[model samples]
Target: MTSQDRKDGIPAGGAGGEGARVPVTDGLRFAFGTLTVLPVRVTRWDRAAARAGMLCAPAAGLVVGLASAALGGLLLLAGATPLLAAVATVAVPAVLTRGLHLDGLADTADGLGSGRPAEEALRIMKRSDIGPFGVITLLLTLLAQVAAVSGLYGESWARGAVAVAVAAVAARLALTLTCRTGVPPARPDGLGAAVAGTVPVRSAVLAAVLVTALCAAAGGLFGISGSVRHTLAVLAALGAAQLLLRHCVRRFGGVTGDVFGALAETAATVALVVLSLG
Candidate 1:
């Protein structure tokens, strides 16, 4: 059989952009495609799965939207209050990312709260336990988010879902923004260099646009806006995301995965709460 014929459906060679023969496996599936964490027993596949992996960063929002709707449906079925949906809209992300942002939040809080230099703040961020400042900061952020999301749930579900979707995509856009404009990898290579730096600006923009558009579609489909509140909500969340990311890039250099996670969660929460008001 020819080289192409000898291969299964998987691309035979020239997978990762060169003439090299990339491995094929489920791990490669996740890494290469929108499927996060590999399909199964496959992470080392040196092949490309753009149509899938490329979507992973943005698809996160779609997953979140469905997750929120699913959880909300479940709670509603159980005869619980819509307020319980707030848990799905808000808490699931923490569970999804395993509270990575809390780490960033702690790191940010500990860093800024310490009144130390930027380098020292980053160093403290690498610490394990939360300081008093971190503790207070986490509490306040959580309170603000919970209060906002819960309040929104009482009035509208569509806005809450849209918030989740928009915030999710915008957070990645912020990461892309930070990734493109910043110092190089702090170490030889970590997550930043491996993925962030390599992501082309247009690719990042496309991914971001795709996510943001999904949100706008949701809002438009549901007619979820009235008065000037909708515009303000979008502006506020996107604004918060931009300001925070810029601050971090200026202070800490490039963005970390922790920072990205925090950005998405915080922005989504803020949008939901703010927009729901009017």
Candidate 2:
């Protein structure tokens, strides 16, 4: 695979040149091709395509979230314990994305914890092996996810499933905001450069609003309190992701693929934790 392919699992392609009109299907292809290990082909690599892909990211997350919920629900129907169902819920996203986001999370953690200058820290993150920081962060993150999910499962199957779905969509929504205009790329080449600052600020905000509203509607199945909780969870997740994005920009000079991964995981964790609360 070329560097472009390595950026986000998008196969290197030359379709959709600059000034080419990007169709919605191309956008969907771009989103799934890069964000997940799905079999979609990415025929476009231009800024417009990237913008569309980022906007459609939440839709891709919805599919992933539903898949996660379905597996957990099935396991429960099979007489499995809540803990086992939670594990499956947490594992499905990682498996679907081929652990791309998780790997990025580890790399970002190692880079941030290196205590070195920006350039050196970026080099550290690029190394193949995981450092102590990466190992510890991954351990804590996964454990927290499983624990929170298990708690929700213990409450009720619907609660657990909804939480997983909400968390997944919120995670990708964070990515959309991260790529909004004004965020620069950390490197001249890579996924960051390809997608950084691609989205218009208004478009990104609109996507967030729409997603939050949909999530709130989904939560309405429970009650008024459920709607409020889901709305707050999304807001809190976005706030957390924004904070991380700002810090990473300051520390690394701008956004990177690893930073994107870190933001997604942070948002997901925060959303799940919030949903699991009373």
Candidate 3:
């Protein structure tokens, strides 16, 4: 398979392009194509396109969040158990995204758990086989997501749906933060290198702040739990991302495609857990 078919797929930017602005439409196409299983036509392959995609990553998350909420809402309306509804909500996004993030999460766990040099750890991550660490991490993280969402649904369907959407958006926002300037790629090539340092710190900060505010507002509107709880959920997700950032940098030397996926899953899971508490 070509490099584009890899876990992180192709990097947003390619060689031999600079100083020209990419259109919003191009960015949308790239974000949707790269981040989701949705069929989108992405013709541009340059630094500009990659930058646009990072900026538009939240848009893709918004779409995924809505779908997750809809699935959970349908299950709840159909008289399914809260646990069942939460499971479906959690499972649907994984299916929709083709389990890309989950794969990343597993690979990251295996890599970090290996306790080897950065080079060896990265090689382990590139292997297609799942290790014991990957399996255990997947089980625990997925269980946490299901349990948290189920608890939130037990409180109120509306609250659960809001939590799902907010978590999805927050997860994608983590990607932008990870790609911010000064962040190094784990390898010299591939998805991590292509997009690493592509996001400016200012842009990342602005996007993160806006996404947080939007999620908080959305949670207040749909959160039967409490506006404060919703705000806390967003903060919790951000905190999760921060922790992941520190850990990945210290452990792997920098971010990789797997790191991005790992961050998203971690943030989403923690956000849901926090929201469930409300």
Off by over 4 Å in 2: 1-4, 8-21
Task: Compute the lDDT of residue 166 as modeled in candidate 2.
Answer: 95
lDDT value for model 2: 0.89
Cα displacement (Å) at residue 165, model 3 = 0.3
Worst 10 residues of 1 by lDDT: 1-10
Model 2 agreement with the true structure over 163-234: per-residue lDDT tens digits: 899999999999999989999989887788888888889989999999999999999989999999999999
Q: Report clashes for each candidate as comma-separated counts.
A: 6, 0, 0
lDDT of 1 at 185: 40
Q: Rank the candidates by lDDT, best first.
A: 2, 3, 1
Off by over 4 Å in 3: 1-19, 222-225
TM-score of each candidate structure, all chains considered together: 0.73, 0.95, 0.93
RMSD of each: 7.9, 1.9, 2.2
lDDT by residue (118-217, candidate 1, tens digit) is 6677678667788998788778776776566666556656555555555555444454444442334432333433334544556556655555555566
117, model 3: CA deviation in Å? 0.5
The models' CA-based lDDT, in order, is: 0.53, 0.89, 0.84
